[model samples]
Target: MQFLYGVQLLIMILMPLIQMVMKAIGIGFVSYLGSNLIIDQAMNYIVSQMSGAGAVVQQILGLAKIDVAINIYFSAITTRMVLSGLNKLQDRKRAQVWRAPGGTSIEA
Candidate 1:
């Protein structure tokens, strides 16, 4: 848990550090990344999955956008990772929560 906190903190701290570098480069790096082909592909994939959800949603609510869902998905996945990592990190709680501890360690 503490380790995951460290990682999340590291990510949050580094984002601005990196963004500062991009800003120094004279092109708003946010806009640069936003215009990337990979983003387009990811957004298309998410919207396609929403359409597959099959509920006539877009007709009734014309605002079912992929950007919102993608942000939600990112938060959900990141939270799941950090919490699950923390859950496994607690020595006393590990056996209760996970089938194995020292999961990547053979010395156990």
Candidate 2:
């Protein structure tokens, strides 16, 4: 019937657009998981640990009457190192693909 043909034509026309939207949503969900679940938690833990270490160093310098400016320098260096490490980690995660023992690829 003409109605059946029209329905088929409409579905054919819409399929690609539907697929494109689904792909975009999948990508966005993965990005959200990577940033919110992984990176943010790791950054928080790193910053907290670094701050504790910096505090200890500050105390030692304070006792020695050394200028506290050195603490600032060390903090800057530590931050850069942490950022570089996190960037490498992010890149590695992005590049990695998981596979099963049976040679099947797993997708995110």
Best by lDDT: 2
What is each predicted model's overall lDDT from 0 to 1? Answer: 0.67, 0.70
What is candidate 1's TM-score against the reference?
A: 0.30
Clashing pairs in 2: none
> Which residue ranges in model 1 land beyond 4 Å of their true spot?
1-62, 92-108
Tens digits of per-residue lDDT, candidate 2, 24-93, equal: 8997688657655654565567556645667778577568655455446455756776688689778987
| RMSD of candidate 2 to true structure, Å | 11.4
Per-residue alpha-carbon lDDT of candidate 1 for residues 3-56, written as tens digits (9 for 90 to 100)? 999999999999999988878665545534654555567767877876776467
Total clashes, candidate 1?
0
Clashing pairs for model 1 are none
